[model samples]
Target: MALPDPNTSWPPKPWDEAYKVYAESETWRVGDADAIHEFYRGERPAATHRRDGELYEGGVVGWVSSKFWGRPVPPGQNRTRLHVPAPADVASLASASVFSNPPELRFTDKQSKNTIDRLELIGNSDQAHSTFNTMGELKSVFGASVLVSEWDTEIADHVWLSAYGADVALPEFRKGKLVAVTLWTEYRDGNEYYRHLERHAVGAIEHALYLGTADKIGQRIPLQDRDETAYLATLVNENSVILTGIDRLTASYNMNLPTWAWRKKGALANAGRSDFAQLYPLFDALDEAYSSWMRDLKLGAAKAVVPQAFLETLGRGRGASFDIDRELFVGLNTPGNPDGDKIEQVQFEIRTEEHEATTTELWRMIYRTAGLGTRSVDKDTGRQLTATGELLQDDDKEATRGKKILYDKRAIAEQLAVALELDGKLFAGKGGGQFAPPEVRFPDSAQVDPEKQARTIQYLSAAGAISVWQSVKMFNPDWDDTAVGAEVNRILAEKRAAAAMVPDPATFDGGDPTQDPNNPDNQGGNPDGGQ
Candidate 1:
């Protein structure tokens, strides 16, 4: 579909629902306490239960606050509604697991590869590689991310790509391939929202500026009204379309993982699934467990209950506090009491063991549900393992990383292909040609034991379980067939050269120098023995 009609309702039903899902993931990913509490409360406005003439906020949101209190906590109370940000942590872990070492991009044609290399140098500061890392995190969070390649003569001669989260992306896919997309940026100015929507198609990109409110799309306004898009008015034609000299869509849709579990059914049923999906409840529980522990710590602090004489007064209207360091106290006795009032210490026992077990269990569930194995965290110490740390690459984490890599490889290939085409067309004198999708290769997970792997490969090669070339390929996963073959031939040639260095016994007069007849010492040895 072309640009939506000016007055039409914004974000059609599918997109609206998709955005809601994105919003939920985003709230957890951001881990904003207010946003989390507000989103959950708004999500279930009627999620309130009445008990003993009091209404309490229900569900995990309220549970975070009232779990320890055993009642609804007032706004100003000492309730600790701590948010763990497990969603953010999980997404980041997923991204780091896949992108700690960015993928190496190689083109089939030498010129195409060189052109891309030059474009990357001049386009932005390692634009494609760095953007891939960013997109990985976003794909993990939003389940999908969009990559759009474009060129601006005013900015630079090379083509650049932009990555956007699913929240701002309105993608149109055909047969599992993205053919068109409309990416927009919105900012609130005072009470109204200003939006700039850029639609990318095969040959043309349309730009539209809208003056909207908080919930309404308002109307389409002239591009001149918005400074960000004002330049488009001069570059675009009457319909605000810029003719990009490319055959394929410049935008590529990258999914984190494919599944039929997208909230919106029908055509989009197989869309990408977020890494945080099905893990929100676990996230909430994790936060609740942590907050409850913190509350216990606060409530369990030791207190001294002293008599009224030990109190210190600030002012007439101010409250008083019992200070044990007062150092001065007057002796007093009640009329009917023989002993004076005494100070007593009071303390509550903190359930440290219970809280630790609960939070640890919750973290394990989060790691497993997020497709990261329990090894993602050190259960004993409760420390999250970094990507570069000693993470045991279990079957589940490896499979999930593999799936994410698969999606990343396809998206990167398509985006780079389109980028190359545009680079050639937009810059006529620059390098250009018919290029197929480049061979994309990703490296192994960061924490893999390379020495162990090398030893295994060596043992296999020695046992004839695998060929030399196969061993080389296994050692270098990012290498293409040609590169692997070249390395294998080099190894074999070195082996042959080493074999030629050994002496041939058939050509030698004597195998041992001490027994050679030509040696004077050997000839004299017989004479000395005879004497």
Candidate 2:
């Protein structure tokens, strides 16, 4: 149940900011500014993290970068909820380390250290980490990674990592905090894994230059290394003018990016993702990249400046999205009611490469992620995530809750499809007479009645489930099409006959007809019937 690989992009593509928030919280960093968060705001801390946000009872505040401080109405008087800044700008009187930001560095308690330590441990994996020896080191790594990651073919546009080293995203002033930035890129295969893929940042710098310096004055300009950072620092103050420049230079009219607003933003966030309803310092600063201090430095903003089309198709691209796929969690973790179709499009991908134990191991992973382990009565059989890394739509056999059996036939059907696809059996029909398919793929009806025993065989043949015959057909072109068709027709006819039959005990002509009809004494004939 490890997460699938990150999307095949340097930074992640545009994602709902709330999801980032949820991911941040899941990693255990609290109160660090610029931290993207992952949330599950339900009645009882709808999540695993010890510190939880208290929302305003029955009401919601919008998405923002700041946190809310508030007082409660005592136990029975009224229930207290996490306060948000935008819609309900209320304050909370009670605060703790888990949900709220730590005002100042205090004695390290085991509780607080547990989270940071856990994150540190995870970060230390050979894959990537956020620990830095100094602010400069952190800045350097963060900036370089951001720059380089855009070209990583391995990362998913939908998934992003925490910026343990960033200060712009992590500030001391906010009452609430989270971590990370979201960016996008395509993917490339690493010798072992995948890396980001993107054009060059210099191109972006040039575009910003032409838009910012050239459009306003109608003069062409050159890009100095610091020019990009300078514009980022001042862009917030002069948003309209800069956006206009961007539109002019790009030759596109749409430039007011859909950045989430704090009050307005939080309102939408609350309306959309309830998980983000608690804790906030306001996202205002989160979106704003440069401060006067950083502005003076030549450091580039951690945010991405890219084409809108790139942002729109974040999770999918060449190869597939593996670890960084977000749906994996939602499927295995909180797959709400059956109606919550979010599970429908999910696909399963196991993290292992061993073919021998693939099926068993896959199921084991599925059961594990679903919190059902070896001790459970029913163990899932094949676990996997889609290219984007999510549980494959409860494709697990829909068995009785307590019985642990497969309830949905589609599960088996989907399995057949995958198999057929792998073996290249989907296009197994003869002579391109009038039916050459546009794609080499499997159909959905790969399952059959188990009671019939041969039902699977028949259905597979009819539905074109994968088979070795496809290979034979391709390799042995001399095979007779007419004979194959005739044999297939005969087989189908017989199957249909078997499927349509019912037996009668009275109609048998076991003995001489007259003698056995009623067996007269025992048959229709007479006492002489037996002799």
Candidate 3:
């Protein structure tokens, strides 16, 4: 390692140059720690603190500019760490999470250069989560931590039904009960929990939209009883889509997602994997039927969901019109004493054509209801805001971009199978590049083992499939949802419903009706005179 060059302008003239040099060497760190500055700055959460400035808003893809909440290392002191100051107050988040008009944002300006990449934030529980693994390269962000527990209802945050017959609707049918699911996060003093009800439907689907908005993204984990393989096969067997590439479709297999109407055939019944598999298809169908314009607003005023606002206002056009009630747009908690533009007077109205589906508006409700946006406030000034509603998009994109991952294991087997048929040529055991690539449309179970299929292309690149496909795969990891997981949940939701149906099998004794066949059966099967 070269010794520090004292004569070379001490610590390099421009701070960036010095930072760059330090970054390449072991000496760099975010904070003054000499050994790990690079990791500090590099691994550090994107510092979200920003000043009161014009924010980037209202365009298909526009730039956001704001002030920098930075902790520049002292010259000789040697600290380059980047961090979001801790949040002490709850209202602080609502206050700090600001969307201002961009004030002469210039790339050259450090503060302006810190424009947010993209936005998405969900749930109050994340604040309770102790880890800062939201970092893109880290797995812990969405990864799970399992806890062993006794089968007690009082302990679980959410409830999951294991039986209810894999094909049955939740509680609507006497036999087909719901498979309950629970998600719990232990906090310092208590825990935060979310429970989900599963529903399903059966269909031969050719194409399905990926779960687009953020609210539904991370909730795809399956229930214990449903086989992941069966769920995926059903999705592809019924609905198949073959893509040529580039935001364009080459072919759709069986049929397309039911557009603009109730699917009398019920596309989601028995569709996904597991006891709770049906949930996604129902939501997707709902998103579609309502033209993504469900009456329930996905976003609320407090959420300050930018994309919802942006899409509702304009999917990037100056004159796009919509027909949602303007009343729904009122009463977002306004910021008090805002240091910047004081959008305390925030007001907006959208114009939509007579015929365009309320698709964009649909997402807004999903965004708001799912808690897609909100942020933490600056500790010192309390005026600085953190961009939350938007899940840092670019980073999520970069984190796993074509990040070679498993679709299922047998993809390699298929390649080898094809190879053997051609007289035993060796497979390089690699795929997913500009030339030879893995087929992304979840292959059918008969085509290949769904488990192995899930493992195959999944091995090459997780994010590389047509970028559009990510949404589809992101929510429907098992490839599709089930009607049971979709509808049953909505049916037998109340816990008490379980008691109304299943009698205690332990006490179900002493009844042999089969032998008597109604004592009138005495005439047919009597011991005295058999007819």
Candidate 4:
């Protein structure tokens, strides 16, 4: 399992099942009509195909199609279908709830000023917060995601991180801690699939290129065989091993939820569960509900069942038309028949109330099942709600966000520590501190009112309950000790300057001519108001 063997079954054993799960999740994440239909149709034991009577492709026989997305109709009839983007929407909501305000990142080693500076520089350069926000959404979609930090001097001076989804990332863990991972990228040349697999172990990264089919890893080939993977050949040895100077793996796999991949056995016992894992059926049903709503509208369109004589004939070779807009029509000279003579309007009743209720019920279930309580819905009225409203009121969503933040804190810290370690070893003098994980803190879900917070801090400081230093920290939680000290000093210096500007009470005349030595109204009196 160190490196993929030639002509071997790809994604061996339990991974095959895991891949199936990933594929299904991927389909939902995409939220595409055709792709979802195609994926779901393939899942059926047998496709039931029926021809569209004398209309579609000259009534040619073909394989089964989707009832929702690929429903066929007669020659000129319109097909109605709808797809709800609930999966992506839920994933994005989960991501934004956790990462709307970037987590506070800090290294514990204060003495390693150089290391701190290096870490800060790397974080800023790599836009770690935004990258994590993106990864949060991916993990929500795929159940788990991987972060790989590498020191590539050619790419950038500092260590950079790469994110991989559960589909392509093959991870190995020991007691729930990631020990190794193999990440692969697939490229398709016509029908052939070419994969570049890179495995990250403790002290080395191994790479191999495979010329494979869509479903099989065919054989190992030279990296130079493909233009995309050619650069890897120059970076790795002939054995395709690149020695990492650090003693730890550069990759960390983070799960979105605490639910383990119990379906998989052995050392890879604990894996993350996707938000959409058991909710696929609900999502499908949701689409069906909305689609039915639209279908009702389509089917309920008003129509006039006109007699054959009523249709105005266009000139020879052209079709006839029932011109409802016409002011007048030529009289039918033929004898009138009771059934065929009278025009009858036909319109199916649209179940607007029923559809809306069903959709609302389904959405409520979806919100709860996804751990988002009444997300964007008024619980009482079942109406749309604002994002701010949801944030303030949705306790379930906040709890979910809190759990995700806690999970990500450890993974992010570990990966950052690994990055620092890699930087210390790969680029010797760049970073000088101890390579240890930092304390990661996410912003509180319910943010305190800033004005109220400031007032409380001022009151506490004035009452002597908290020192000026502590007050400064309360106002700016993310500030380092140096910044806080600088702020405290500035405040004290300003207070001293104001005090120096005030006139001394002893020197003040107090509007009394007798007390003023310069006043001519009376003889000079004692300066202490002893006149």
Candidate 5:
């Protein structure tokens, strides 16, 4: 099929219509994406809800609900509530667990010498580790992230890899395979609109369209008001075109497994669902409870009682007339007035124990919903657990959620396969060799006790239940197969050297020492003496 013309109609009438439908379907999801972004930025929905005049009726004036009227009512204050660190904590924990150490790439054929180098080149080039780390964080925040790979001639290695959030790239799927992808980019130069689009369709040449509301001389104008000549010139001669590109077609892949939706069976179902989203309600509740507790404390601390007569004598300025730190004196027209002798202070106590308990419970709920164990918090005091304990708790949970990490491993393997295929097709002349789909290895998330594991491996090795190589591997999980083989060779060399140092009895005289000791050499004492 011929490519669509930019001059006749860009974005096509049907595409525009479809985009409208797609955008409409994604309205709520877009909102969810925004919320997820806010969450990552430490902004909680509770902050918005607790803002004055938002969910409340008459702003701060009508905040006195009947149930809270008698109590110290906390008015809805902007930015007063603490946005619980649940989102950030969960994201950090997940990212740390997923990529605490860099992943390993293994090839099925051990003789494929270039496999490791190629994998390393791609992984280390273009800041891939940082990009992957960000992707892990994105997965925790937005439920998904995307990996985009392409060959750029201008780049140092010619392989360009990038990670994108869920907002910009849209994948079109046919059956289970990705058929096409649309990437959108926008920018502004002064008052001009610059929009670029790259549409990659399977088995077809990739198309690039750049539209700007500026003339050739850089005069700003409305897109529709631009003349036909200017538009046609912009379409044809303004940008570079590629007739042949890599054969794999799609340049991007969504790095998330589609196990669940943003919300359960709704318009936003297609959107990415975040673990933080599940704990949003808990965070909001905690914030509200803490805010109320603070308000009560403030009100209780400021509570005081004043006499009506004193107020009248001071002309309603009694508060300014008396110093709280000094003794207050009230004068009466009469010589001695017992009523003005003393003023009583109102006493009110805050149920701090109850507030602390409630806050602790909320924190526990947040950690639990985020897939962090309850022991993630201190069981006794409800404070954050120790770092080592937290890590252990995360490891336990990750062990149970091994399926999730496995999916990540598989997804990354598939992506690397695609990248390798593209590399072979486009950059094979640059010393990039073809490779089979490599096995991906993630760090062991269930590593509870390394010392105990090492001891167990040692015992097994001593018992001849496992090979020395296997024991070495168990002790050093980060070592690849080649490294393990090298280590085994090194140990064997050491053993041979040690054996060579000590001569056996049979080899002492260059003969079997166990042979008859009465022989001439064995009876040398008498034979040599007689000689």
Candidate 6:
């Protein structure tokens, strides 16, 4: 559905509805809504839960806590058990998925080469690659990343790309195209109501809503001080209104700032399901298992069985004097016996191997569900596996990740085309003609043996199967067709220059100055000089 007009309705219906939809979407995208918030604040869920008395309760007062409180154990002996791997792993995977290599933009039409170069220059000047990489990573975590492009006179380059997370921006689409976006920024200003500055394509609107109130329909809350720019006022006259506040009105100016959305998984019904959602169960299971394993290991090592006679000898009140220490020895008493026998210490073995196996399997599952494959964890040491192994291992993963990258690239390209078209009309005074869509080139994700690849290219070039320019391109994938052609011309020019400098054997003269020009050395030998 199209965006609701904010003028006639005062407040747009879609704005309120979209807010709820985005909130719920974000909740599902981040897995546990509360935990993900905590993560954003740099708090580990496992640590927070433990601190809040969720993981464990009470002090080290009972028999189990008393004996095992300070003793060394296999599992909880270190602080590793309290660590949560899901968030870090997810972030790492997300980073690796996008930032491993940079993307290339190619223009099919030679006439659009200047435009392509200008776009690339703008991207570099504004650090668009880094910004987009960060946005892609955010999409992996939050399920969606929205970006808006605008012309900024302040920047050296006139164009700029700004990235926003899914939390702040809400997009409305019509006929499979992004028509409008509503962005609301909330801040505190020493009032009961939180001030909000809502921006749309046409203009900016200012309003305030009550804090801590559910922003639902018919809340009876007063709208404090509504203000809008002249641009938005103009939109009310030009667009259609369905009585739902500012319906189908353009928010932005003639700029047509395109809103690009990059989703972790394409076209999901629940747009909020993040890349890490499916693996959350595995993370939870691993966390709980590690906690239990540590507890068991600690208790098992400190567990000791004592005879009642030994306790009686220490006396009822003096039993507290007995300290459990590695170097300390305790004497046990036998009835009617003068000699004291050594107490039999209870031996309990922690099933550390079993816990390790379970955790290994959980890690494998987490990696697999995250599309990282089971080889993500090393089989022998249970540590994270490196990505340098056989190409087959990462083939499927690269394919999946490549598809996402390509999808996002295409969406961004569409927005870029709009931006370019608008720039041509407004700045260049051209008739806003649409240029050919640029082709996006992503780096090969699969690992290739460079030596073997070079040999194959060499053989192909030598056998006349592929042109020298094609071989050069195969070896240097980063070079565009223009660059390849330039290099080829340069080589040909150098060869022509070298050929011009050399004397042709057919026109060569004899070393003897006296010899007749163009005559063979033997033909002129009969005269004064011998051949």
Model number with the top TM-score: 1
Candidate 4 deviant stretches above 4 angstroms: 46-79, 124-126, 260-264, 315-319, 333-344, 379-393, 427-429, 446-531
Displacement of residue 306 (Cα, Å) in model 1 is 0.5
In the range 28-66, model 2's lDDT, one tens digit per residue, is: 234332232223222123333322444443333222112
Q: How does each model score on lDDT?
A: 0.77, 0.26, 0.25, 0.76, 0.56, 0.52
TM-score of 6: 0.55
Root-mean-square deviation of every model:
7.8, 29.3, 31.6, 10.0, 12.7, 13.5
lDDT (Cα) of model 2 = 0.26
Q: Clashes in each model (backbone N, CA, C under 3 Å)?
A: 0, 94, 107, 0, 1, 12
- Candidate structures ordered by lDDT, highest first: 1, 4, 5, 6, 2, 3
Model 4 score (lDDT): 0.76
What is the TM-score ranking, best to worst?
1, 4, 5, 6, 2, 3
**Candidate 3 lDDT tens digits, 1-531:** 111122233221222232232232212112133233233335334543334632224321121111111223423553222321111111122112110110011112221111111000101123211111111101111111111111122443221111111111111111222122122221121232222222221111122212112112222222322332223333343223221222211111111111122223233221121111122222233323342222222321232323223224545556554343444443234468233322233333322331133433333333232222211111222333333322352223222221211211122212222212211111122211121212322122111224433554464346565332443354345545464355435544654687768878899886875566566656556555566
lDDT winner between 1 and 4, please give it. 1
State the displacement of the C-alpha of residue 361, model 2, in Å, after optimal TM-score superposition.
23
lDDT of 4 by residue, 407-483 (tens): 78877888888888777776778784346688887776534447657877977978989998999888897799999
Model 1, 1-531: lDDT tens digits are 677776666776567877888888888888888787777656544546656656545564465453222234555566688888788889888888888777777666556545766545533256677787789899999988997786788889887777889888888877766778899999679988888999988888989888877767788889999778888899999888998866888898898887556635754664588988888778878888999898889889998777776677887999888766766777477778644567778999899999988988888888888888776367466665564453353667888999888888888888777787777777776766556877787877745557667878978978989999999988887799999999999999999999799777778664676667787767755644553
Tens digits of lDDT, candidate 5, 344-421: 787568879889889888877777766656664565784655667766766657763465576566556666766765
Q: Of the pair 3 and 6, which is ahead by TM-score?
A: 6
Itemize residue pairs with steric clashes in candidate 5.
Answer: 506-513
**What TM-score quantifies how close candidate 1 is to the native fold?**
0.79
Point out the worst 10-residue segment of candidate 6 by lDDT: 250-259
How displaced is residue 197 in candidate 5, in Å?
A: 3.4
- Candidate No. with top lDDT: 1
* Residue 260 Cα positional deviation in candidate 5, in Å, after optimal superposition: 4.6
